[model samples]
Target: MRILIFGAGAVGRVLAAMLSPHNELDIAARDPKLSLIEREGIFVHGAADRKIWPGTKPQGIYDIVIIATKAFDIIRASESVNEFIDENSTIVSPQNGLSHVDILTDYFGHKVILAPTTIGATSTGPNSARLVSLGMTFIGSSSGDMDREKTVAKLFDHAELPNNISNNIIGEVWTKAIVNACINPIAALAGVPNGTLLERNSLLTIAEKACYEAAEAAIVNHIELTHIDVFEWVKEVMRSTSENRCSMLQDLESGRRTEIDEINGVLIKKGESNGISMDVNRALWTMIRTAEGRRLP
Candidate 1:
């Protein structure tokens, strides 16, 4: 199979290393990251270990096009890879929020697949990514095409990525978004690792409240989430990736734009538009926005 990963960030690199051995792959990245992979190859450590040398860019249509760019950068990434998508191409969205999946649908139509993953990994460097927690990667179709989703699931299975094909990808995406909504903002503002938050009752209380608010907001919007216990989910994630800093925290520290708007902001907007209250989640969103303004140029 031929695949193209549009962005080579932590998630993209992790996918590249995972899929490279099983299929012919190409990475769409720029400068340091692109050149680094071409030179030293990609090294993944921690939960999973693999090394991949991306030799050259492949030509022609690809079977799979995974859009691993940040939520804010999805448009640019989608546009840049538009020409590479053919009728049979399957585009996957492993993004953190709900809006990005819609944005991709606008650009690529029904080819867009919402396949959010709970796997925790961070880019240690341009060519090195460390797997923090090997969470389940859920693949589901927003367009209700079970066959298509299962086909994508096969690709993941071939790559040995822990994944499941779901009939409710939207719920999965929302569930994942709320989980991030619960931890990301607090973790970023507190300037602490994920594990520290779970260890402290005060932080856990804040996360639990945010989770409840986000869940209420989603329910009000007519979205159905899976029957997973969110508070327990948050605790398990914290324990799994104890020392890991989430993407929002990483972005703030590096002065890069964060995806608070897409995660917490989504819940806030839904609550405000529908007369639902999302106080705790709204507070987290406001604080993260203020931090982003101060940190980014």
Candidate 2:
């Protein structure tokens, strides 16, 4: 299989390294990082450590194109690789938030797959990454094609990546978004690791409120997510990634724009549309945006 990972950041590098040995893998990166990876290959640490490169810009339609870019970059990344995608190519979005699948499906139709992953990873530098925790990734088609979902699951399994085929991917996607909605911003604002949110009663209270609001919004939007208790799920994630920095916190610390808009912001928007109150999410969204604006030169 020929796979093109559309970003060389933390998640992308981890997936690229894991998949490169089994299938032909190519990373679509930009500028200095692109040049560096082309020259030195990708260096992966933790879980698996090695340098590998399937090459770049190879001619032919890719069997699968994984969009591992941040939520905000989905459109630009999809457009950049439009030529390499065909009716046969499956585009997998392993990004956070509920909006990316819609964006990709608008461009690629039924070929888009919603992949919600719990795998933890952090970038040490450009073209380099470390896996923090191993977790299962759920794969399902945006159009609900069970065959396509099974195919992706098989591919991921063959690559030794943990995966499960989901019959209700939208529910799963929104569930993950709900988890992010509660934990990410609190972790970002508290300037603490994920475990801190669970450890501190005050922080945990705020997180619970956020999750409740997001859950209410999901219900109003007709999204079924009854499989797991939201609060317990959030706590489990916090415990599993106790020392790991949530992506939002990482972005804030690095002075890079976080995915506040897509995560908490999306909840606020959906809440309004469904006539549900999202004051908690809205406040967190505003706070994160304020922090982001302060970093501007």
The backbone clash count of each candidate, in order, is: 0, 0
Give lDDT per model, in order: 0.84, 0.86
Off by over 4 Å in 1: 55-58, 294-297
Specify the poorest-scoring 10-residue window by lDDT in model 2: 288-297
Per-residue lDDT of candidate 2, residues 148-234 (tens digit): 788789889888899988888898899899988988999999999888887899999999999989998988888999355888988
Give lDDT tens digits, candidate 1, residues 186-296.
998999988999788999999999888888888898888875576787777788777888889988988888999889887788877888788898778878888878432
Clashing pairs in 2: none
List the RMSD of every prediction in angstroms.
Answer: 1.9, 2.0
Estimate the TM-score of every prediction.
Answer: 0.95, 0.95
Backbone clash total, candidate 2:
0
Which candidate has the top score in TM-score?
2
